[model samples]
Target: MRHGKQTPEPHEHGGDEGGVLVRGARRYEWSAAVGMLGRRRQVYDGLVALSGVRPGDRVLDIGCGTGYLTRRVARAVGPGGTVVGIDPSPSVIGYAATRAPANCTFQVAGAQALPHADAAFDAVVSSLAIHHLPADDRVTALREMRRVLRPGGRLLVADFSARPRHLRLVNLFGGMTRHARQHHPMADLADLVGRAGFAPTGSGDRWPSLHYVQARRPLEDVSAGAEASRP
Candidate 1:
């Protein structure tokens, strides 16, 4: 298996041998302060290639720890567009809340049960996350992402591949102490996206610790009523 020169930091729920999660989320400050310089470039390159977020577009950034990417998305979408960054961790959200640009906003929310309406966003993006939740939740969250997107909206997810057979196992072993769960291998990610009513945009680079899936919700039959409401 290929390994990165840079090891992922611990997730908040430290320790292994419990729930399926993998490594804990790194300290929010570390990611916000310096991680953005590199991750932001990757995100910008991917979103621009896949979603084509124009000025005035409404965007949602899930798992937006530190809101760094949210800030970048906000800048990309410009004054006309709006970007909302969401994370379940209050600490991460707190950091992001204070520093986000005027056009950006933040909320405390989980991926599976996003507190948004059908077709609420023009584009949705996530990075370095998604594997922390269970396989079922991953699918559920993807469906939620599709539900909130405008007809013809875009969904861009940048994460480590659950792909290659051995990588996931390694993550589980390495992250046990770090509190991370390993879910669907990379091969299954496409199927999950398809099951969620998304058509593949197919621009993924499975190298240098980055894996991504970009999908589009066709405008032809996007039904606002088809969205499932959460309790």
Candidate 2:
């Protein structure tokens, strides 16, 4: 059920380091795992709302495993808009591509080095994926996200933020939940987003185990605007 070429070249930025990639049959397991959380549709729909994405906005989804959230964003954007999803795993990318809506597309790339032009998207979002990134790479990935967004674009990042005791019990069984157990504190994520040059807007927790931070790229880049105007 794969689509397009088996291996499409990734973005020119090229680094594929940081974060774990889900591959093979394991990629198919996410749907069930997510269902265990209950209210799956509502949780993800809430993320779409938190993202502030509107119809006709060009959106990007980083670490878009299985395209679950990407598909939802596509619905929000409508046919006038387009959604591009990137993940480091070719397997999941292929899986996602098969089910992608006409206005959506999938690519193989990592969060730290997104394969898109600067100021290309109207909004950027990630769900339950930031925790999969290595600590050092998280900021770098956020910077990349900021770079891809147009001035005034919205940014939303959600990840597991369950208390340690709760995570410990979940991690005992291993698998994907292991990453959740080791996720960074949501405060750290807020700080990182700020450090990446986004203006903090809001943050909160979703039922089950997701924490989200919302921010906006400053409405203007004075230095960049000055440089452009000079020419």
Candidate 3:
């Protein structure tokens, strides 16, 4: 998520100084919850495969909580490649950096304002992260992802589908539809990716509630795309 000043906090409705209180005023660590999500290796593997990462490629993992997916990508890219994991949480970034390989790096940064040059990455990927963003930040984040990608660079976004099958019970009983509604349906995600100047290639479900959309920037007019990112 962007974690921008314009967007409301996830627990803005009610929470102590620490984090969100989901049930009976139970305090939950937001970063810890996200870190646990990183251990869903099945979804991570599926997303990495869909991303088409290759040896010697340069990749950026947005909202890369704890670097689970980032390490997988680094292995795929091999020693010749470089993988950078960026997240808004400094604690997670610090933890990720400790375990990261020489070829991999972690940074504390938001997706909406990436600290990278235009056309810097061969592939840009995010998993289970975008849904946390507010509506406007989602667009800006998508555009920012496109801005950093090389011409014809691949884009892979993996998140829960709007009507998630796995979390159906939670959605119904826990009054979690508010969260579910934040997730984009397949069509909406495709449209957003397209509007961000990426050509939609395809999309598919990976594991329950986990789906991915694949896209790429056009090869022609790479320079124009770079110029457009300038202030």
Error of 3 at 190 (Å): 0.9
TM-score of every candidate relative to the true structure: 0.73, 0.80, 0.74
Report the lDDT tens digits of candidate 1 across residue range 30-141. Answer: 3322323345466555555565777999999887766767887887889989999887765556556778889999887887778898888999988655665655566777
Best by TM-score: 2
Q: Which stretches of candidate 2 lie over 4 Å from their true place?
A: 1-15, 25-35, 163-187, 222-231
Those runs of model 3 whose alpha carbons end farther than 4 Å from true positions after fitting are 1-39, 163-187, 223-231
* Model 3 RMSD in angstroms: 7.0
45-86: candidate 2 lDDT, tens digit per residue: 999999999999999998787787899999999999999999
Q: On residues 137-192, what C-alpha lDDT tens digit does candidate 3 reach at each position?
A: 66667888888898889999887665555444434534423433334454467777
Instruction: Give candidates' CA RMSD values in order.
Output: 7.3, 5.4, 7.0
Q: What overall lDDT goes with each candidate model?
A: 0.65, 0.74, 0.69
